[model samples]
Target: MAVTKRVVLHFPRRLVEQPVIYRLVKDYNLEFNILRASITAEPEEEGLLVLQLKGEQEEYDRGVKFLLKSGLKIQSLSQDVTRNEARCTSCGACVTLCPPGAFVVDPKTRQVNFDDEKCVACGLCIKACPPRAMEVHF
Candidate 1:
């Protein structure tokens, strides 16, 4: 099983507007679960912004590289995932569409549960959902 991890990045308020974050998402496909992030200022230490990122291992490493290349400061990093479990109607839509087999339908209850570890964050299941239940977390 792949272990999920969280990475927190701290940056100056000026660096936050550099548009590098978008580039990372577009280029490397960084999956981010934002927990707590904001730009704050103090009397002595102003113009500082904090960003927290939670995602898979690959995303974490790439995000670090993206931040480093952009000249942003790294604050903290930890292993964690803020998962969003969605209800599955068991219409076999997710089963057929989910390439990673992240979704599984219970034979007894007809309910479906999605495993984030197994998921590659593909959006195919989202389109295949008849009830619009499956949501891809980035």
Candidate 2:
């Protein structure tokens, strides 16, 4: 069986410069789609990356375990973005900030389409939505 999961990874300073994604792809044979990233070798902060991994169930499980054993903080994501229909104006403000184009405007109806599958919980939509229609959890 095939499955995909979104998770947040926090890299310690020691592993900040490592090719973590490359390892996940080459060793685990997992497909990694980076949704959001701010990883850097900075003095004040740890590296952070939000991504979705796709592969066989067993491989996915082992890959997550490998990440944990490698000292990377891995938190599986539940739901990323949600929208309140009544509060939305379909103004398309969030379309620009969304990296994955999750918030798309339907040209036929001039309505906004909120595809949860495409969202990675980047949290940029929360501030970009003028009416605060979009909410982000974690």
lDDT of 2: 0.84
| Candidate 2 lDDT by residue in tens digits, 6-91 | 88888888888788789889988999887778866577778888888999999888888889988998877645467888999999
Q: Which stretches of candidate 2 lie over 4 Å from their true place?
A: 79-115, 122-124, 133-138
Query: Cα deviation of 1 in candidate 2 (Å)?
Result: 0.8
Model 2 root-mean-square deviation: 3.6
Extract clashing residue pairs from model 2.
Answer: none
- Residue lDDT tens for model 1, 18-48: 7766775676666455544556564343233
lDDT of 1 at 14: 62
Residue 133 CA displacement from its true place in model 1, Å: 40
C-alpha lDDT values of all predictions: 0.56, 0.84
lDDT minimum window of 10 residues, candidate 1:
76-85
